[model samples]
Target: MDHIFSPWRYAYVTSRKGDDGCVLCGIGAAAPSSDEESLVVARGDQAFVVLNLYPYNSGHLMVVPYRHASHLGDLDAAVLAEMGRLAARAEAVLVEVYRPDGVNLGMNLGKAAGAGIEDHLHLHVVPRWIADTNFMTVAGETRVLPEGLRETWRKLRGRF
Candidate 1:
């Protein structure tokens, strides 16, 4: 019924860059992985937290190990524990801020398993709310979010 951002900016804002290279690797190089704009919330020795640029939801973040490996077997115990801990932390933060009714916490191992970036071992933490699904995603090929990425980041970062 009402609008927040301009309609003209919507395409550019929501549009994901479809280049002929590895997006995950590019993200790692683009910034220090600690900047909020880079979508890196918090990081430790073995792993780090990064927001999924192409997200299922606004607060969708990826908990990934510092080491670049494709499969779960490649990750060590520390890295695995780091991923698990970060996932739990992300869930708590999202719950505290957005109060989502449910969460989609898991990782797609391979391409067949729906791992968009299968080459990189990472876990996705997607926040889900009641009545979040709609025709926009099903029909319009989009997911209209209520808040901007910066706004969502600001709210979620406080919990970290």
Candidate 2:
């Protein structure tokens, strides 16, 4: 038998119980000193790349525009373009650092669409490998990530 200890996630799970405000906007507004804590990996002029604090995988990242817009129709063409560019960069960084079998990229437009933070638009860059999904996630309702978010940030931060 084996056990996975992720005590750091306790704070996140409990703290977000009834949290308000747009998380993406808050991260965008955070200062450089807060990068590690916020899990922001890279910042661009129009958009930025950040790690999902409660990630599906070890390198699950999100490319988000700085503007606080929920719908894709609300974003400017430049912001949309930059988001794509940043997604590409994120994929490259994930490949370089994690070397997964493949990657999953997507966006959830609204709460009904499975967007946890439906008020802020973000594209998820989730790295995947063969046989990565297991009983832990399906049967136990638990995710087994290979590495911690902070360590993943350290590996990907300089690359972006």
Candidate 3:
């Protein structure tokens, strides 16, 4: 029997349309950082912090700019600075909540660069720790998340 099962999961599809609309543009500048549906962490004037609805780690989040830019080089300087600020805030929140030993901050540009959603340029902040990766990934082809998304969102949302 070849059955795929992802236990203990909750996901919010960020978007399915990218033909004419920009993922960053639709979310807006004044939207709540985390809505029950959207799972946003914090919102800034030029940036938005959102929990990765489908995450590598429970607290995984993306800091997205308000403007829609396909490439990293196209980002405005102000948005870049704001991204840094949001990154710092994300680190602080993760420390306060998960207290992970480390974190991974990155942006995968374009489809060739491993960007699953290439049209939306966003920075990913994934919390990490020693032994966080287990046999599930190495041998079982699965991941064991220590906490659920809702619990993580509750803990993280309180910080901001």
lDDT of each: 0.66, 0.76, 0.68
lDDT of 2 at 107: 81
Kindly list the per-residue Cα lDDT of model 3 for residues 101-145, writing each as its tens digit.
Answer: 888888777666666557778888888777666522523433556
Q: What is the full ranking by lDDT, best candidate first? A: 2, 3, 1
Give TM-scores for every candidate, taking all chains together and pairing residue i with residue i.
Answer: 0.76, 0.84, 0.78
Error in Å for residue 115 of model 2: 0.5
Better of 1 and 2 by TM-score: 2
lDDT of 2 by residue, 71-156 (tens): 99999999999999999999998999899899988887775567767777889888878777662263343466777888999999
**What residue runs in model 1 are displaced by over 4 Å at the alpha carbon?**
1-22, 29-34, 135-141
Which of the two, 2 or 3, has more TM-score?
2
For residue 73, model 3's alpha carbon misses the true position, in angstroms, by 2.4
| TM-score of model 2 vs. true structure | 0.84
